[model samples]
Target: MSAPAPHGPAFSGRVGWGSRPAVLVVDLCRAYTEPDGPFALPDPGPAVEATSALVEAARASGRPVVWTAVRYAAGLADGGLFVRKVPALAAFAEDAPGDWGALTLEPGPGEPVVVKQYASAFSGTSLAATLHAAGVDTVVVAGVSTSGCVRATATDALTAGFRPQVVRQACADRSATLHDTNLADLDAKYADVVDLPEALAHL
Candidate 1:
């Protein structure tokens, strides 16, 4: 890790990849990618393209790929507290039309899709069990909003006994400050913040 964040204790260590791994694509739905969508980030192109390449690489390597989306019913009853905190979540309503919450990545036939109501993909979802059942000890995580779902998923992945290797180029946020800050924290504590090529080679 670089020098300690100006205000926090120094953190420096690497949790190397395990023998078995899976790719966890977090919240790369149209709601976060489409230019005109309610939750769209500023210029999601780089993250989208990088993640697409990583997805293809993982598939070629026969690694399991898990995708996630934030989808709730029309009433927002399923969203609960999360919806209240970020009213923008209403854009992800499952009943919404015209790709408001469509998956940007083309999930393969056998790839499992996890629908989550919270920031962490493992929260209120069966992601940990699915990864465990598949013997996935390391998770190659990528996708949108590095400060939100990507960061949360990485933290939860660590808590669930999986190594989270976050690909920097494959994750993004509307603000560079949020993206970099979260990446620094994740690398310093919860996970390994790696480059796209490094993660692809591991796959």
Candidate 2:
């Protein structure tokens, strides 16, 4: 079920390079993007491609391009609700082949990588301070599990006083229904939702 768009304040968009926006790519790791393989969530290929574009744009514009990965130590003991949500996630060992396997994007030069244990990147992490330090008042997010991590982060971003701009086509969940529905819900309430081209135009 695709979420229905809400009728509210029309957002023309207040985020762009002019405002020192940062692009946060969340969980594009193998644990969620592989096709129909283990730990896979829907098709994240398009999201990856779109995210890559955003990364390049952010880099070109001299803004922060941050990436986040969800990882536990090496055992379930380090994982709490994460262990309960999908016990299989514990398999993301140091470099062992688990779900979609390990994430590939290594932080290059200035890119800040945040490792988190929960759905919301803002939870128990220095993400807020980092964004503040970087003078980023708006966030452009793209990543996995639209209904979970993406939604949680967007909500947190809003509450934290940063404008959250979500790329509708740059995030995915395990189900098309879930991805679209969550996008609709986030669009109606929490974040600014727009397709890639429109987002780029506004930016």
Q: What is the C-alpha RMSD of each candidate to the true structure, in Å?
A: 2.4, 4.2
Off by over 4 Å in 1: 1-10
TM accuracy, model 2: 0.85
TM-score, one value per model: 0.93, 0.85
Question: Predicted candidate 1: what Cα RMSD to the true structure?
Answer: 2.4
The pairs that clash in candidate 1 are none
For residues 1-203, write the lDDT of model 1, one tens digit per residue: 68766436556477899998899999898887888888778989999999999889989999999999888987787989888999888877766666677898789999999999899999989999999999999999999789898999999999999999999999999899999999988898999999998998889
lDDT of 2: 0.77
Among these predictions, the greatest TM-score belongs to 1
- Error (Å) of candidate 2 at residue 109 is 1.6
Q: Residues 1-203, candidate 2, lDDT per residue (tens digit)?
A: 96643454563334332366888988778767655455676567788888887777777778788888876765555678776877666665444455454564555697878988888999999999999988988898888879988899998998898889999888888889888888887877788887788656544
